[model samples]
Target: PNDALYFGFGKPPILVPKSNAIKRSYSLTWPEEVVGALVFLGSLLAVRGVYALVPFLMALGCAAVTTFLTLKMWRLIRARELSFYRFNLKSAGKLRKAGWAFAIFACCWIGLNAHSGWIRYHEVLGNFAFQKIQVPDELALAQVNPARWLNSTQRENILEGKKHYDAASRVALFVNSEALPKLAWFEYLLGNAEQSIQLLGQAASYQKDESKALSLYYRGAILNRLGRHEEARSSLDQALAERDDLILARQEKGESLWQLGRRDEAVAVWTDAVRRNARLALVNNELAGAARSLGKLEEASAHEKQADQFTPNDPFYQWMLGRRLQALGMSELAEKHLRQAEQLGAGDGMPNER
Candidate 1:
């Protein structure tokens, strides 16, 4: 994917003649030949990982072409014929004539890479913003400042991530789908669930491997929050089918199942998630509650202990615990954790339009 390879592949005809005719063909030294050979060897080694049949065959073809050109170069040196001296000069002159063309091509490629880097910057920024805006806090939804406990990052402590979304979306529009998942999450944080769903659908249409999975997971999450458990389960199942390692999707899917009155299924899902990643303190907490509801006090106690032991002290996990507590009608305890989390850092705080 480097520019050198891209240019070489793009103009193979030009490369063929250029590789065959070097300036001072008869003066080629052993050291220069060795270096060229080493470079070709490295290229072949790099291509060795091309396992797909068609790609492997294509690589082989390119290698064969490279070998042919290399052999031609060697032949020119070994010939030591004054006959090719004039021909070499003509080839050299052709290269000089193409100097402007090469310069233009290099400039275009550089500009393209520069723009791509800018887009990637926004994508990374959006990803960082998304990490902070994963779940909405009820307090955030109800308040203009959202995190009353935190030293406000905003003037008068307005919502947090709107600028990040705006910056990312501005550049993200140039890309087909790179920042779509984060953009969808941004919309959700702004209380635009329908718009978020639409964005997610747009992202999924790209069918990019990681992005598609993320879009499905976010869709499932939005549906779960809207109480559309059946649709949420479907989206989460598709997300998991694409990437089973998405623990958040698994957690949300369990919530969807639980909301659908499939208690045993929900327990199974949560238990599987905890088994896959023991550090999922939120899922462990869910398991603890499920056990408590089933009257298995001992099991409930064990899960609760594990949850406490494994829970991360970060703002996100603290917010998760606060939200879980709020859902359980433990408002005072929930408020305490939410405040603590906000004091540490704004947890899923949105930007206030006002």
Candidate 2:
């Protein structure tokens, strides 16, 4: 029930328009906050799948909003130095004050976005949002940074107290199942796809209370990654039978279908995921990917533009925006997004494209 209402990706960011532009009745775009909400929804169309995908859209959203407002404030401050534009340090320093606002905004915004990733076991899905949901105090645990795996003593403390809890009856016994895949994914980043597949296999065995649908869904994902399309499709179809909302399973199935040269079928699979998770921009991105593959550049651009409405400032957002423009044959605008994306940090938390 909790998962049903708050089921979108983490909350989309909040955008407060800087007062410098308009104090009156004229409006061009939606208010920044409204746009942020939509962007968040668009990014989360994959819904829970975002968790498995290395926190991409949320990070992208953060980058976009930060870059745009930061630049806007920067310009506002400099506006004073110009003669007619005028530098009267008498300025309330609201422009400079924006730094404080953004600082708080970024922290709160990113914290909410990153909280699930950082503390998946801590709060049960909407435990933070809806007050009525009761979460056990024990559930407030944080993640162990794999880079700094717990020392034996710390690990002993956690396992000693929590080890005996009744996970056998848990709906999410497969929850920790994510840990090994994440480890393997990092290894995959370092060029070990085979080893990553092996790790995911191992993780699959630990799942205790998994539904057949979920089991097949995860297995399908692994098989697809391993290039075993026929098997992946079988598993995906089974998962879909149980829960039509399994976006990742459907996504993997589509990938497998595409690899099998069933282009139309692949598109159909993705289109369903997009419709189910309308908030996830990545689904739309996947749509764009399919369009590009079909040589429908204009169509790809349209979908990508919708993605841009969410994250307008980040360099990567700019880069993606530029790519969409290029698809539409707009060389200059495309170049701008490309250049900005290059300037921002693309490598941060990003998996190797290979």
User: What does candidate 2's lDDT look like per residue over 23-140, in tens digits?
Assistant: 6763224564565555454333322333343365665655565444443444445544311123322144443344455445655654444443334433223222222222211111
Per-residue lDDT of model 1, residues 258-348, tens digit only: 8788989989999989888988776877787778778888998898788878866676557757776556444544575577677777635
lDDT of each: 0.61, 0.51
State model 2's lDDT: 0.51
TM-score of each: 0.51, 0.37
Residue 317, candidate 1: alpha-carbon lDDT = 55
lDDT of 2 at 6: 52
- Model 2 lDDT at residue 198: 68
Name model 2 segments beyond 4 Å from true.
1-212, 310-341, 346-354
Taking all chains together, the TM-score of candidate 2 against the true structure is 0.37
